[model samples]
Every structure is written in C-alpha cells, then in structure tokens.
Target: ALSVLMPKVKVKKNAKSGKKGKDKKPQPKVNTLISKPKAAASLRRKLSGPEDVPVPDDDSGDLDEPAAAKPAKTKLKAAEPPTRLTRGQRKRQQRKENFLRKFELANLIGKQEEAFRTGSLANLADLTAHLEEDKAPATAKGPKRLGRKAQAAQDEREMAQFQGVLGFKAFQADPFGALEQHLKNSIRLQKEKEKTAAGKQKAKLSQLKEAFRSKKRLGTVKNKFAKSRKPKK
Candidate 1:
C-alpha cells in the first residue's frame, strides 16, 4: 500500500531524443596483423554479411585438366644474297692478303737468322744465301699509279713542291726581290726615254743654229741692230 502511494505521486518519462532516425557516419577500417584465431573470427563476420555469395575454391576442377601446349617457336628471317665486293675493295683485300703473306715470309727469314746465330749449321747456309740475295742491288722503279685519286694527290703534291722551288730561306730574306726587279726595269726604261728625248732636243737645237747661220740672221749685228728691231714697236 505504501509503494503504490509513492509511485502514484508521479513517474516522469524522458523524451527518446533524435538518436533513433539519425544516420551514423561509417569510420575507415584499419587492418592490423592478427593471429589465426582473430582472422577466423573476422572471416566469420565477413561471411555473415555475404552468406548468399559463392566463395571461390582453392582447387577447382580446371586445375586437374591439362593446359594447352605452347606452339613451337620459329625464327623467320629474310634470305640475304651474297654480297659482291667492289673493284677497289677486292684490290684492297688482295693487297692485304699479299701483305700478310710477305709478313709470314719475313718471319720465316727472321727465324732462319736466329737459327744461324744459334750455330745451326743447316740454317747457316740458307741464311747466308738469303743475306747475299738481299745484298744484291735491286732495280728501282718509278712511283706506282694507285688510282685516279692517287694521281690527283700526286699532282697536288707536285704543285706544292714546285711552289716552294724558290727556297724559303731566300724568299724570307728578300721577300720583295721580284717587285724590286720590276721597279728597276721600269726606272731603266724611263731613263732611256728621257735620254732619247734629250738627244732629240739637242739635235734640233743644233739644226736651228745652223739654219740661222746659213740664212745670216745672226752674228755681226749690234751695230745697226738685228733685223731693224721690229720698228720700235
């Protein structure tokens, strides 16, 4: 009877507030290294959400089937025709081969010499023969014609050599010798012309004097005057 009387006095009901319908913001998930048991529990939680979705099996029937064999690889290449050497290239190759052959011969000669020095009696005669052959005077020949380019190079070299025929020392000592010679010739010619003109003038003056004497328009005057003195005008 006493409890009923106390509750009957008042029972205030607080409002539910706005928490019921408001949506909560989802937080970003962070994954830490978890033990197997923790991982299994987490997997269980995830499986609970997607219970209808099918999970992939680790060993499917496809793994039991044999895989398709890979096709054998083939290298495809274009057939290349043999290259023909040019005339110049062929000549150069031949010359190189000849040079190599000569080098071998020289090596053989050198070995023979070495053997002779070691008192090999068998090699001594051969070495002496070779030395004698070498000592024999060889006939020298004029320069060989290699090719057109070589001829051009030779011409250029000859021109250069001819250009320097007047020794550089003399040219450096008197660089203006040619010019000086030219100037001297000019001066000599001018002097000759002047002497000729002087001789001509002297001859003309002598002729005039003879003409005056012959005409008697000269000398003995001074008394009456020369030719009447032009009428005092």
Candidate 2:
C-alpha cells in the first residue's frame, strides 16, 4: 500500500507544484545577498544614520490614523484592543500545535537551507550539539567573534566527514575531485579563458596592423602612372 501510494502522492505533490515549481530551487538567503529585509535594512542604515532603526512607532495598531506625528492621547485609542487565547479555547489545539510546530520547523529548515544555498559561511557547527567549551568567554568581550584560526577549522573537518557520507560519495563520483577541486578548476579555467582572449586580442591587433600596411601599399602603388597624386602631408 505504501509502495502504491508513494508514486501517487508524489504525483499529486508534483501536480500541485506546476511547471515553475518543478525545477525551481529555493534561492539561498545568506552571504552576498542576505534576506531582502536585511538588504533593505542595510540600505536604510546607509541613507539614514545608524539610529534610523525605525523604532516601532506605533505599538498601537492604529490603521485609521494619518501618516503625520500623532498626539500622545491620539496614540491610545479605545477601538484598538489586544487579543488573548485561552488555554483550551482553540479547537484542535493539539493538531494545530502539531501543524504549527511542524510548519515553524519547516520554515526554519528552509531558512537555513536558503542560507546554505546562498553560499553563506555555513555554520555547520550549529547543526551539531555544542558544549560550553565551544563558546567564547562571555565576560571578556570586545569585537567578539571566532578568531581567524577557529573559524577556519570550525566546520572544515565536519564538512569533509559529512561529505564522506553517501551524498559526498555521489559527489566524489563526479569527475570533480573534492568540491574544492571543482572550484580550483573554475578559477583555472577562467584564467585560461582570459589568456586565450588576450592571445586572440593580440592576434587581432596583429591582423589589423597587417591589413593597414597592405591597404597602404595597395593605395601607394603606381596607378598605371596616370594619376600620381602626392601623398597627403
């Protein structure tokens, strides 16, 4: 039954995800471009001073108010009221909690995946459980971050070992030596391409020079000695 349902369920899922969803991978959310919100925040910071961290001006959710500054009394409106849920009030709270927790976890997973996809410095260590020894001393704080060497070695071994698993093996099966080799090949290929381009440019320059000389020679040749026009000074 599970075997029979698997393909059908997969088909339904795929059908739900139309053409655009099939091959489309979620974009990474880390590195070069952080989340859009982060990028927008950075822009806002640049435009406005650092203090432009738009403090939640209206803790009060007053949608009807005008855009301009409001009086303190205006900030407090009777129409706006806070909402509270009772312990047992929500129907199917257990199911809702289960679904909510699952959804939250999925969202978190997608976020992390996006970060990884974006080629951010994957904090693989966070994936593994850590102890107090792993963290820095909280008391002595300055520009608190992992030092150069620690950050360098942080997930190096872990990543390699993880890659050593079946997935890594599949990757290794690819002609590309460890992923680093593929990267190195890319850099080498780019440099070689530049070199080839440079060579072509030189060849083109040489051809142009040769063509110029040929044109000059052809132009200067005796035109049956009829029109011996003097060359322009």
Candidate that would win on lDDT: 1
Model 2: CA > 4 A from native: 1-177, 227-233
How many backbone clashes does every candidate have? 0, 2
Q: Can you write out model 1's per-residue Cα lDDT over 105-180, one digit (the tens) per residue?
A: 9999998788768876775577799999999999899877589998899899998976884666656578698558
Candidate 1 local lDDT, residue 205: 100
Residue 196, candidate 1: alpha-carbon lDDT: 100
TM-score of each: 0.24, 0.23
Candidate 1 matches the true fold with a TM-score of: 0.24
Tens-digit lDDT string for candidate 2 (1-233): 22321232222234664544546455533433234667756665666676733546766756676688765664555675766767676656787889999999999999988998898766756655465456646676577688889888977978886766546654758644566676898899999999999999999999999999998888767563546565656
Cα error, candidate 1, residue 1 (Å): 52
Distance from true position, residue 24, model 2, in Å?
A: 99
Instruction: Report the alpha-carbon TM-score of model 2 versus the true structure.
Output: 0.23
lDDT score, candidate 1: 0.73
lDDT scores of the candidates, listed in order: 0.73, 0.69
lDDT of candidate model 2 versus the reference: 0.69
What is the Å distance of residue 29 in model 2 from its true position? 99
